[model samples]
Each structure stands twice: as C-alpha cells, then as structure tokens.
Target: MEGSCKMKRRLLMFTLVICSFFIAGVVSADEDILLQQLIEETPTGGILELEDKTYTGNIAISKPITIIGKEGTSIEGGGTGNVIEIRSDGVTLDTLAISGSGMSRSSQEEHSGVRVMANDAILTNLTITNSFHGIFLNKSKNTRMSNITVVGHGANQLGTQGNGIHIMRSSENYIDNSYLEKTRDGIYVEYSHNNFIDNNTMTDTRYGLHYMYSNYNSFKENNFIKNVGGAAIMHSDHIHLEDNKFSFNQGSRSFGLLIQTSRDIHVLNNEFHLNQRGLYLEQSTSNRIEGNDFFQNEIGIELWTSSTSHVFIKNHFNKNKVHALTVGGESNNDWFENGVGNYWNMPLLDLNQDGIGDDPLEYSSSLSELVEENELAYLFLASPAITIYEKANDLLTQHKVMAFDKYPIMSERKPINVASVGVGIILAGVGVYVYRRRALR
Candidate 1:
C-alpha cells in the first residue's frame, strides 16, 4: 500500500512540472512574436524606437511608422546633420525629445529638428529643444500638430535664424494646444491657406504669430504674452481673430496686433492690455471690430492711411493714453456707433437727467495726430491743455460731451451698481472738502 501511494505522488509531481513548462513556453512565444513583429516591420514602416541613449545619424523616413519612446528618451543629432527627416506620408511622432540639428542658415534652406516634407502626418506631445528650427514644414499639406513644445535658447542672443514652427507654402494645417517659447518667431506661416492656430501659448519670441502672404486663417483663444516683436499679419486676407488675449507686449515698435495690407478681417472679443499699441492698422481695410476690450495701452488703436471703411462697434476703450480713433484721410470711410459710445473715463454731464450726455464727444484731431506720431504724448495726459480741450468740447456742444443710448450696452459688459459709483463719488467729494477746509484753518 505504501509503494502504491509513493508511485501516485511521483506521477502527480511530474504532471505539475510539465504544465508549468508549457505555460512558460507560451509566454516566451508571445514575447518573441511581438519583438519579431517590431524588428520585421521597422525597415518597411521605419520605426526607430528611442531610448535614453544618444543616436547620431541622418534618418529619412520613407514609410508610415510610429517612433515611440520609453520615458526619458532623447535623440541627439550631434550638430552635424539633419535629424529624423520625413519624406513619406502618414507618419505619427509622439512622446520623444529631439535636439541638435539646424545646419543651413539661408532663409531659403535650413535644417530643423524634425523636418516634414510629407502630407497627412500628425505630430503630438513632442519636446524639441536647443535646435535651429524646432519644427519646419515645407511644401506639405494636411498636417496636424498638437501638444508640442518647441524651445530655442537663442544661443547667446544671436537669435534663431529660423522660426520655431515654420510652415512655408503648406496648406490645410492645424496647430493647437502647443507652447512655443524663446524662438525667433513662435509660428510663421507664409504663403499658406486654410490654416488654424488655436489655444496656444507663446512667449519671449520675436513675433508670437506671423502670417505673411497667408490667407483665410483663424486665430482663436491663444494667449500671446510678453512677445517682443509682437504679431504681424501682412498681405493676408479673410482672417478671423476671436477670444484671444494680447497683454504686456511693450516696446518701441511693438504692438499687440499689426495688420498691414490685409482685407476682409474680423477681430472680436479680444483683450488687449498694457501693450505699446493695442492694435496697429496700416494700409488694411474692410475689417470689423466688435466687443473687444482695450485698456491701459499706450495707444488703443493706431490707424495709418490704409485703414478705411472699418466698423467699430460695442468695444470698450478705457485708460488708454491716446485718442480711441485717429482718422487719417478724409476718404477714410469708417463708422462708429453714434449714440452708443465707448468709455473714455471722462466725465459726461447729463444736465437733462436723461442718462445720456447731450453732446457729441469731439475727439481732438491735433491730439490724435500727435499721438499717432509719438507714443509719449500719454505723459502729458493730465496737463492743463487737456482740461482746456475738454472745456472747449463742452462749449462747442453746450456742456454735453456725447449721448448714451438712454440704455447703452456697456462692454466688458458687467452689471454696474449705480449706487456704488454715486456713493463713492459723494464720499470722495466730502473727504476732499473737509481736507481743504482744515488746511485753510
């Protein structure tokens, strides 16, 4: 009986060992299959898996493949050649860091970190740093870029010869949810069309957003803060700007938005604050401005001769140093809301108790022209000359500056408690009178 029991135990142990070996073989086979697929498909599909190691080579991708990375993967180009050039269509790049490219300095020919000459490609979640041009796309179409970070250190302030993201002669591209900092131009689109730039943050760049000879594009919900050269849109048309913020962009020739030789554009609901000039329109016409906020700027809007036939409606202009509108030539056919006026922070005397001032707000031509020439005219804002001008306007209009629409829609359009302004004014007046009387005594 003991021998029979020993035999059964040995048989059970042998069967268990056989089952374990079979399971191990299956797992190993699955791993080998995956690795084999990766290696086999790499040459045709051009998949170069990235790790923390440095790879120095000129790789041209001719087929569609995804080059993925384990976290902390870096591709170092060694500053002698182009890195990861795409010449094929339908490529995807994600979660990789590429650096050390950019050999050519000619504006026409330059090497970038990732150069795409293909169509229908997507680049996402890439960190491209310390390169001449971060991402350069030339003569490509139907490209999409999102969640990309392009950083150019400027290499001792010589400034990048190329742009962070350069799209030249490319069409139907979309860039969204990206952050571009410390580059020559954050994003430069030249001779492209049907592009969309939305929800991006750009800083410390020459021009945050530049569209030269590009048409029919849209910029929405982007924050361009502290950009040095500001934004320039020249020789473009059919552009639309909505819900963007341009703030603290101050310099001699800097402006929040510059439109030159552009037509049929619409700028609405944008906030421009503390900029040298909130908006500079030169030789651009047929634009509509509505529901925008311009505050604490050197000049709210500077219109050179090319700005004509523009409609300014329901825009809030407050605390700006110069005239709200500077009409240059007599042929400039611009329109403003007659009764619905902008806020200048100047007192309006409602003598008839009608809630609307009885006179037209006569903006001074000399002052406007002077401000157009010199931005420092803002320093003399509180001088007696301004007071005299206000009085003269009052006399010309019978103590009525401008009439509000009985109920004008206040833009930036907050609900105002009338009692608050009234009580504060009364208290301020009482305090001033008391102080003056005490000083006399």
Candidate 2:
C-alpha cells in the first residue's frame, strides 16, 4: 500500500508539471497575439499604453501613433529581428525597457532594439540592453531622443557588437541626456548633419562620439570617459564641439579627441585629461582649437604634417609629459591672435606684467625628432630609459624648433562656477548646524 501511494504521488507531480508548462506556453502565445490585435485595433494617432509586463517583440508601427509603457514594461525580441520598428512619422515611444535584438544573421544585415526610419519622432525614458544596435536612425529627420540608457554587448566583443546609437544619413536631430556604455561606438554618426548632442555620458566604447562625413553638428556638454577614443571627428566639416570633458582614454593610439581629415571644426572650452594623447590632429585644416584645457596626458597636442591653418589660443596645457609634439606641423597657424596665446605650464619671464611671456614658446624636442625619424621609437615611449634620454637631450642638445607660439600668455584665468560655490556654502552651513545640535545633545 505504501508503494502504491508513492507511485500515485509521483504521477500527480508529473501531471502538474506538464500542466504548468502547457499553461505557460499558452499564455505567452496568447499575450503575443493579443498585443498585435490591440495594436491593429488602435486607430491612427491613438495611444497604446502597455502594461508593466514583458511582451514579445518584432513589433512594427506603420502609422502615426504614440505608445506609452508602464514603469516595468519591456519588449523582448524573439531573437529574429529588431524589437521595435517605426516606419511612420510623428510616432512617439516612451518609458519602455527594450532588449534582446537579434544577432547579425548575415554580414550585411543586423538588428536593433529600436529602429527609427521615421521623422519627427520622440523617444524618451528608455532602458535598453543586449542591443545589437541600441537605437538606429536611418534617414530620420527632426527626431528627438532624451533620457535614454543603453548597454550593449561587451567591449571585448567589439568586432561583433554594434553601435549604441547609430545615425546614418539622418539630419537635424537631437540627442540629449543619454547614457551609453560598452558599444562599438557610443554614438556613431555617418552622413548625419545638423544634429545636436548634449549632456550625454558615454564610456567603455570604441569612441564616445564618432563622426564620419557629417557636418554642422554640435556636440556640447558631454562626458566621455574610459573609451578607446573619447571622440573621433573624421572627414567632416563645420562641426562645433564645446564644453565637453574627455578623460581616462588610455590605450595604444588612443586620444581624448582625434580630428582627422576634417576642416572648419570649432573645439572650444573642452577639457582633456589622463589620456594617451589629449588632442590629435591628422590631415585636418582650418580648425579653431581654443579655450581648451589639457592636463595629465602623455602628449597634450599632436599635429601631423598635413594638418594646417589652425588657430590655438587661450588654451591651457598643464601637467602633461610633453606639451606639444608636431611632425612637420609648421602650419603657420595662429598661436597668438589679439595679443593672446595659450598658457603653458612652464617657466616664462613676464617682466612687463602685460600677461605675456617675454620669450616665445618654441616646441621642439629631440624625442619628437626621434619618433618622426623612426616610428618604432614610439613603442618604447614612457620607458625610464626613454625618459632619461629625452631629459638628457633636452638639457644638452640644440633642438630644431618644430612649432612656435609667439606672444604666449603667462597667466591662466579660470571662470568661477557660482553654482558650485553656492552648493559648497550650503553644505558647510548644514554641517555646522549638525555639529552644534550634536554638542547640545
């Protein structure tokens, strides 16, 4: 009788498990179909509010509409294609957690968490992960995306991972207040122009921001840290970069900012620190690199031969191992305009108190000469022997000047941040009040 009872119990447990599996399958299928049905039933220009639950992906919006999601709403791809595809203009997607885009099934094709091919769309408050491409804008115009957080495949798989935000042939768009990490490039823009990117943070990617064949884009107030390259502006013209921070981008051939084959770029009031190279220019012309700060970099500025017609004024170079290394960069560039040149963290005689150095800054180095003559010397860079040699050469040799900066500014004037001061004073007052209360107690 005991054996019979045990067998019956085992049969009952197996049946329950089977029933649960069958019910789960049914529910998943039902939800997917119901979601599609609901979307189909919703009229154009209507709103489809999603529940705080997971929904199967491969959804497409072909009409002008808005989709609002609850706090925990998610759309997960079925590992076949993009999670969401927007095809019509005036669409809006907000407050959605999206992930699991299909892997590259072909060499020429890949999927994205959200693919926007429409114009005048607004996407906000999104959290996306495991995205092949987190968000893709293809020929989209006047689109705005803000408060987006994306995490891509690991950087170690860079060769296979797609970009965090890919904009191709898209123009006149805005991306603000976004955070992206571990993608191929944090925000890759190609043939996209008149875009505004502000107040974004990108890290652990190939580049925090990348531009190729794009023009008239503004990148401002962005934080780029721990990427291979903080930003790479290449083959673009008439771009503006201002008030950005690039830091801790340390690796081979890495730079806080790299401008290559670009022209008419305005790099102003930016900070570059703790990088392999602070600012690198290659084959670029007619750019304004002014009011910037370079600190704690291996090389503050590196100019290749073909880059010319640049203006460098009111910038500060401090605590860098080498201030500027030029390889045939006798650009006849204007280092001083309006009686003002850059401030170098070096000793200079400012006798007249006019805030100008009596002696001009002649950036010529035996180390630079050696690297130019033999590129292999760069491999031994930062070695103690190399450092010793460089110091000895600087002390002993008559170096040939590679670049010159006349009317060098001997002073650095930093603007006071009022908000920071106010915050500090409030914090101090609160601390004192707490101390007094504790003493009374």
Candidate 3:
C-alpha cells in the first residue's frame, strides 16, 4: 500500500511540472512577440497598454480593443497605406501620435493617419500629422472625438489632401474641443446628421466647416478664423448656428457664412466681423436671422431672390459698407416681424421721446425716386432735393425697388437687449443667453 501511494504521488508531481513548463513558455513567448503580432493574437475586448516607445508598422485591428499609449509612444506607417485601420466597434485610442501615411494622387486611395470603420469609438488626445487625412470615418456612429489635434500637409488643393476630420455617412457624433489647421477642409461631413460640433477652432483651411446633404445638425460656439472660406452649408436644412465667431475670413469670393439651397435655418446671436460678406443667402428660404452683429464687413447681408420668407429682426447692421442688398428676388421677405425690425446706422428721428421711430423707416432703393411729387408722396416732400434727385434718377434709369424695411429702429439696439421699454424694444434676453452660453462653454 505504501509503495502504491508513492507511485501515485510521483505521477501527480510529474503533471504539475509539465503544467509549470507550459505556463512559463507561454509567458516568455508573449514577451517576445512584436506589437503588431501581439495585436493580431489578442482576442476581442482586450486592453493594450503600450510603453513609451515608437512602434513602426501599419497596424490593423479587427477586434474591439482599448489601446492606451504612454506619453511619447507613436505609431508610424513608414509612408505606406493607413497608419492604423480599425475595423471593429467600441475601440478606444488615446495618448498617441500617428503619422507618415503614403500620399496618393487618387482620392480613392487616399491614405489616412487613422481609418475608422467602426461604431462607438472614442479617440482622445491624438496628434495626427503628415498624412492625406488626419482621421477618416466611414459609416461610423456615436463616436466621440475630442482634444484631437490634426496638422495636415498645408495643401488647399482639392482632392490632394483630405479633411482634418472627415465623416462620411456617419451620425450622432460629438466632436468638440479640437483644433485643425492647414487642410482641405477642417471638418467635412457628408450625409451625416444629428451631430454636435462645439468649441472647435479651425483656421487656414479651404472651408472651416463644410457640410453637404446633411441636416438637423447644430454647430455652436466655434471659432472659424483666418480661413480661405468660413463655412458653407449646402443642400441641408433645419440647421442651428448660434454664438459662433466668424472673424477675419476675408476674400473677394469668400464670406463668413454661406447658406445655399437650405431652409429653416436659425442664425442667432452670431458675431460676424471682418469678412467680405457676413451672411450670404442663396436659394435659402424660411430662415430666421436675429440679434446678430454684422460689423466691419464689406457686405453685411446679401439675399438672393431665390430666398423667400426670411425674417430679419433685432440685428445690428453697423459699420458695413453695404448694410444689406438684395438681387433678383421679389421684396416678399419680412424685414420686420412682430413690430420689431433691425437697427440701421441711418438718419432716423424719434422726436416724440419714444425709443421707436415716429415715421416708418424706409429702406430706400433707386426706385423710391419714382414716387412723383404729389400728396401721396408725403415722406419724400420733407427733403425736396432728395425728392427731385429721385425723380430725375428714376426718369433716367427706370430702376425698380428691391427691398424695404418699413420699421427700422431709430437707436442702435444694444447687444444686451431690453425687451420692453415703450414699444419695440429689442429683446435683451438673447444677449443674456449668448453671454451665458459663452461663459458656460
């Protein structure tokens, strides 16, 4: 019995020894594997903690993983293909700098620092440079990209360099607190919707923000400064732009904001300064433009005739060479709504001590001179020379009236609005709202 027991104990000891050897061999093999090979071997939902070293090679991740890079850790592509290709959902990448993707002349082969084909990915604090595209998302959704800095090749040539953050057919993404410069477009979204882009600074790009065929999006508190073109919203609708600063975006063809073929847009409390045109609306309809500051622009607002049902109220049009102009549209726009109109830097009188003007202000055109010297033309009779010049010019030129602001405010509406003083007080609520929004952000 004692001998049999000893033999069984030896067999148990032999099994344990083999198990120990197998575990030690697995650990050593894992330590010897390269990062690329390690990623390939890791299963789904693994967390990879990278050391502070450079990993050179193109890495493709097809499983959900959290890659946490230590400071000074980088992934370089060696100038070929995409640096990191993510094909799985719920991937999180943080604290890494990626660069050196191959530049291709063809748009189809455009190389990117990171290409995301997954949903619900989070990319934070990444620095991307020297690539065709900084980050490209294809059919991604619910992605959170924040604190990312992208420096492109500084090429504004179309189809050569891609956007800083490009979203194609993605929706419900949150991109905030990011900076992008020197790319084709800073943030370009196509066929994307329900996205929130807030507090982003984009400069020196072709378009600071460009959207096409996207709708129901809101971009607020963004600074689009010193760009070739500020922003272009084309073929979209139901967009809300609030409290944005469009500054120093000046060129002959460039403007602070361009709205084309869009409808139901709300542009409120925005600061448009030092641009060629503050607001250019082409074929856009039913837009409400209120409480905006249009200062130092060559043209404050230009409304093309294709735009209809526009409501311009309580906006300050000051120090612009041309406060407002309209072309090729019937004067069917509501210049004044709810007895409140815009504040113009024109000669106005409120002799009755009321804050509002006594006479209905006329946004005069060359066609106003066509009103002949008769009892019906009583307003022009106050200035006989003006009336005579209008009559003579009308007889000579025969130009028709374009637009009229019948209730122009007599005083400049303060950015801080006071809703009710006597009659037609500009609402100070919007100013307070704007101030609070900026402060909270």
User: What CA RMSD would candidate 3 show?
Assistant: 11.0
On TM-score, who's better, 1 or 2?
2
Clashing pairs in 1: 283-306, 359-401
Cα TM-score per model? 0.74, 0.84, 0.78
lDDT of 3 at 199: 94
Please list the C-alpha lDDT of all candidates, in the order they appear. Answer: 0.74, 0.86, 0.80
Clashes of each: 2, 0, 2
CA displacement after TM-score superposition, residue 420 of candidate 1 (Å): 28
In the range 190-269, model 2's lDDT, one tens digit per residue, is 99999999999999999999999999999999999999999999999999999999999988778899999999999999
TM-score computed on alpha carbons, candidate 1: 0.74
Q: Which stretches of candidate 2 lie over 4 Å from their true place?
A: 1-33, 105-108, 373-379, 414-441
Write one digit per residue (lDDT tens) for candidate 3, span 1-441. Answer: 999999999999999999975543221112535767867655567667677777876888888877888789888888879999889889889999899887886646678899989899999999999888899988999999999999876744656788899988999999999999999999999999999999999998989999899999999999999887888999999999999999988754578999999999999999999887788888888999988999987667877778889999888888775567665545468877666688887777767554555566655444223332232432332344644665676678654544466666777744222344523433566677889999999
Name the best candidate (by lDDT).
2
As for candidate 2, its clashing pairs are none
